[model samples]
Target chain A: MDKENRHHLWLTVPALLSIGLLFSAYGLFGWTSFYRATPGGLGVGGDFTFDNYLRIFGSWRELAVIGETLWISFALTMISLVIAVPMALVIARSPSRLVRSILLFTLAVTFLSGGVTRAYAWMVLLGNKGLINLALVHLGVIERPIRLVFNWLGVSISLVHFLLPFTVFTLVGAVKNLPLSVEEAARNLGATRMTTFFRVTLPLLSSGLVVAASLTYSLALSSFLFPLLLGGGRVRMVANHIYERLFVAYDIPFAAATSAVFLVLSFVVILGFAGLERLVRKVVVR
Target chain B: MNRRSLERPYGRLVPLTATLACLFLLLPVVFVVAFSFNDGAYFQWPPRGPTLRWYVNFFESERFMTATEHSLKVALIVTPACLVVGLPTAVAIARGRFAGRDLIATLLLSPLIVPGVVTGVALLALFTAVHGDLGLGRLLIGMFVFGLPFAVRTMVADLLGLDPRLEEAARNLGATRLRTFFLVTLPQLKSSMLAGAVFVFVEAIDNFSISVFLTDERSAVLPVVAYQYIRDFDDPTVAAMATLLIALSCALVFAIERLIGFERMMHINRK
Candidate 1:
């Protein structure tokens, strides 16, 4: 082999080794699920069977977790779009750089502060005697602290905060990359701001929003801490359930089966969104 | 009259919503910082006067200090490992004249596509099969698996973004392949490498799902320990520790901004 090919061969080794180990681990995890879990629990023993998959799909409990995960991801992604698109517009197109920089800094802090701290922060904020409750009580809006923590309300708010920066980032890119000239032409033809925005701008933004929603949906689906912490054990998502199946229930086959299914579902949904994005981009976005 | 009517549709509404959105982004973070310095030990509605009690208490505590030190050590090690592994992977994908490089790159980054808890479960099962004990070795391996994706993405983008002519000019002048890479290419890539290193370091320290499963009584990282403390206690010490981490992350964001420009740094987050 020549110098270049030799270098290429050598350079590819580390990537292969790194990816190989993970794939094999996942392969092992997937391989083990095909077998029945031992009666002793936490161990897969006995003959191999398709019972795990059948159990996952046939049972209401397992199917509910799957349905809940998808529904929560979808609902939160839509809510995030409502909040994020306006912020993206401000961050990307506003005349003020000071506003942009401050918003960006807030996003960076929110995005990078890690799950434990963010979860803790929300607990402190949304707890019974927390800031919102205090303010509401003082204003006579309520006579008592409503239950927010350890429920859907708490989880949804915190999850939205977690999902916001990502959607904003994606939408910011879309907003900045907009074909402004086309909008300018619409305005020259006496199109009002609202008409120009909804007609000319929204179509162009569809692909970017699809990308943002895909990312947001995937991240929401995998969320571990928010539901675990803020949901107060009541709003358990698939990730939390997977953990419980092993440590609490000692059901290793179930966790493995669920996660294998989780992995495949993520690929299908994310890849489905990927195809939709291309279709949107092809039709009108570009 | 014309301008007022023309803008009446959502003029005031847009700015109001933007302001609320900004506040929402900072709301939880602001609370975390505020309560960290609370003078009291209670979880009451109004925390007492802000004081340095928790911060001092945290610093003086051995368990907290030890966990912090351990996490830092692991992060320090994981950051360099990522550079060593991810750089070559990035280079091969970006500059190599090889086929299936795209496919290889996708597979390398596949870990990010799945929920990390799945990987945590998989790694837990795999490590247990090998040996039923959790130690620094298994913990490091788990952290490294997740950290490598960030490093590869940043470095690959940086390497691809460089002016190809700089390296080509050196080659045309008969600089050896190794020499040309170090002399011409490495200089331009330094800032992004540092940026990627900061990311990997923070990720290693912040990683919880993977570490949550991998840690034992003897091998617990900060997040794992902090989580346990939170579960057991109602004090502000973990809050103090979290404040310190937030400060460190914010500083790194600023530092990275100065290094590679903030927009470029944010691009590392995108596909």
Candidate 2:
């Protein structure tokens, strides 16, 4: 028994040690601000105070920035879902092997290239003297180039391009899980195609949609590279805000506070969505 | 006859629409490939001329070579470390029947769920709190943290699918528990381990967000180097580097596919 206990202890100890090490590392980094606030800045001598939190709330500029960040995140999520859902449905239900293979390859390429490559692609496409502008001029649509990059529109387009593949993949999984027989049965009952889809298929696909939305929203909210490069510092997301705070301002406490807020907000959004999904499921079952 | 003909057209429409969607997705990638060989330095839609100068330039550059080496080094370190920590935890979770199993699983998988940027920010915060600068140690720690959830989840699913009776039979044959684990159980887990390794390798190599937060110039990985060049200069050198990366990723994918049929290898989510 003693030997067995020792063996189990040996097994558990390493895991515990690793976990402790990770947590300790995290705690140490997080508490740096608490130990030493910047000179002429809020000191960390007292117990954990709400000074940083209050300052964020008290300042209108900060509050507006937060609001703008949330707004962009929300918009990106909604727009990506709108584009992704139909694409996912087409891919899932389509019968052509060539089409399926091509779609999969596209998804794989897009995901593999990701933020850096895609942003570069967009730059080439949207630059004043770049492809789209050149094409427009050749066709006599516009005499001069229009400003596309370094703005909200550019940021949104780049973000959607980056996120669309993942959304489609997730929704495709959901759509695939759905038993085709149920939809077919509804159609066989003399219901219209739209009716069958809306009444039967949509309900079943909601869970997947929720999951996709949560993932998409979180991704959009925390996106840094795409917005930073494409937005040209004009459009700031929460992540960009945090990066600027840490690197530029050297304000660790405020950055920590901002990160904390962002974390809590994301956690709340996820939990709320999960709760709503559960409630909806319960209601439907009952 | 009328209904059959009607359905035929509808089926054709589905294929057509799907083909269009695929075209939309592949267009940007196709553009990248075509431009990589363009002789012109500028990013023109139709190539002014075709040449292999950029690719040649990429091969000759010592900076690109160093960046590639650094990326490989980081991935090599991260992949094994992830396996070491991740596999045992997966085994424990699989074998043990415990309360809060779901919660533990979720916690293990949470890093994947969190956005990369948030993970980066969180890690940055954590590092700063510890008075540690972002360097090799920090980068490894970041990779391990980001890579763990994926490794654990994949390995756990693999373990669950495997029959425990094989290990039990080995033990009954007078083998010690450790010996059975090494001789019998470990060998059978090759495919899962391979899948886990490939997943971790791809992730470590491709990871930008956390690495961006953690790396300084001395420790900078390939993706960051590529990012800097693109942002700073918009040089065609960036295009060459991206082409190389795409080729490398495709090569890795093909290699894995050769080992295990592409379709099976492609599906990383065992659950």
**Native interface contact recovery, all models:** 0.56, 0.24
Per-residue lDDT of candidate 1, residues A47-129 (tens digit): 88888899999999898998999998999999999899888877776667787778888888887888888888888888887
Q: What DockQ score does model 2 reach against the true complex? A: 0.38
Error of 2 at B167 (Å): 7.5
Model 1 segments beyond 4 Å from truth?
A1-6, A39-41, B1-12, B132-134, B267-271
Q: TM-score of each model's B chain?
A: 0.87, 0.84
Give fnat for candidate 1.
Answer: 0.56
- Where does candidate 1 chain A have its weakest 10-residue lDDT segment? A1-10
TM-score of each: 0.93, 0.86
Error of 1 at A66 (Å): 0.8
Estimate the TM-score for candidate 2: 0.86
**Candidate 2 local lDDT, A1-286, one digit each (tens):** 2344234333433444555555554454455434435555323344566777788879887777778877888888888777776677766665665555556656766776645666777877788887778889999999998878898888887788888876876688677677887776776777766676678877877777778887787778778888888888788887888778777776767776777677677788878878877876666445
Clash pairs (backbone) in predicted model 1: none
TM-score of 1: 0.93
**What does the lDDT come to for candidate 2?**
0.71
